[model samples]
Target: MTKKLTGVFLVLLGLFATGTAAVAAPPPSGSTDPVGNDVSWPQCGKTLPVSPAFAIVGVTGGLANNTNPCLAEQLAWAGKSSTGGTSQPRVAVYVNTANPGHSGSWWPSSNTYANVTVSNPYGTCGSGGGGAGPVDLPCSYIYGYAKAYDDATIRGVTNPGTYFWWLDVETGNSWQAGTQDATALNRATLEGMATYFKGITAGKKGPDGKPAGVGIYSTGSQWGTIAGTVPPGSPLAGLPSWLAGAKTLRGAKSNCSLPGLTSGSSVAVTQYVAAGLDYDYACR
Candidate 1:
């Protein structure tokens, strides 16, 4: 969480959906939008933002399918978040994401999860052929789904569906390297997590009268390399974006004008680092 990872976009063999310029309209002049902070296991035993306007807590211990040691205590701290921002939520959680294929200890080998069979869009998961091993789309989807499910059901996060969820996609995590196929598999993994998050929040409205929100957190270039351009029909389409890579609050605010990770999504928050802590600026 201290060092930023850089990633480059891979050239796709086939054309993928391209995102439009999704900019965030700045808050009114002199508007006192609540500035919030995000924390995880890295912040354990450290001082946190004093009464942050809102708080985003990490659910993992810096890897997919892992737990944050301070989750319960952080959630309690997050519970103290104040409501003064526009698009930001009072309490939200993020999960680390990766697509390690079969190399991962918990890589998915089947389409059925928790006894329910999933209809994968990339055909059969274990059916695809990988240069090194089996890194098919279906398996990637299952891997993402299982991780998010574990985070929600067993990661000590109480009532996960009640809070907004952000998928932390960074180059620091284990991802398939090389060609477009890797990008597709990585994208599928994220889409799977989105499906599960959206499913759990279905029919349940939040303070904004919308289903618990699910969004992506990454830099534009990192997202391009990991997921390429998400298809408009894909589950990732239209989700909000939380852009990272700003040095100051002013820089973070300016990032709100940048394009979102997807064509249909809008930038909702821009993050900046100060004193080793990640601070977020509500864009809308």
Candidate 2:
């Protein structure tokens, strides 16, 4: 379907987005500390060729840094996406209530021709609500969120082939900082969101009739300290597993300052420098 036609469908179906941070270049490489920083770029996702200790690629996104124009091409080459008619790239936008997107912003997404995942409506489970909802109940508002996504799909998105709708499991708290009382998240809170997310994308159908499991986001530190430690059969177990970390991405030095998060494994897609960055999900 044409882009215009797709937009029309989304409006009729009421499925769309509406609404931001980050790294200091030339400071020093591989320093998570806000004070210390990185000054080099790897043009790769692993780490420096000679010094493998420093990460080569890192993921960053938010209103602050998403606008780096060269990021996409860097990723395409980094992943060697040019092989097999694969110029398209899969992108994940990171957000919270703070940067919820404008009424009609299009995120730079993957090639409509390919089969891949693009999840939006991103952030922490019990967060971004302005503290109106409960702190964190197992399957708290997450079930409702699943129902909403499923419910929208049933009505039919403009181009189901072009886009797949999914919500963020955690906001700023997707990582841990070893400090007390940051971003309002805990095991139960995470569990509640994860359970609901699981129902929507991976397991049995939700009450709203959406499929099971879609996609998820969390930093590498969050993976090891938070999600990794979760017991088996929990909501987070089924996540697509994008372990956000610190490293060079497409020849840029990117960084994120989300609380409770630290670096670890590499992410499937990197979202460094998120201000004004264009991204979208291709519904072929």
lDDT of 2 at 14: 25
- What are the root-mean-square deviations of the candidates from the true structure over C-alphas? 9.5, 15.5
lDDT of 2: 0.28
Off by over 4 Å in 1: 1-33, 81-83, 127-133, 207-211
CA-lDDT, candidates in order: 0.76, 0.28
- TM-scores for all candidates? 0.85, 0.33
Which pairs of residues collide in candidate 1? 19-263
For residues 67-103, could you state the per-residue lDDT of candidate 2 as single tens digits?
A: 2222343333323321111111221122111111112
The Cα error of candidate 1 at residue 242, in Å, is 0.1
lDDT of 2 at 24: 20
How much is 99 displaced in model 2, in angstroms? 17
Task: List, residue by residue over 95-203, the lDDT tens digit for candidate 1.
Answer: 8889987667766556777887877777665534433325778778887888888989998977777878999999888898897588888999999999999998776
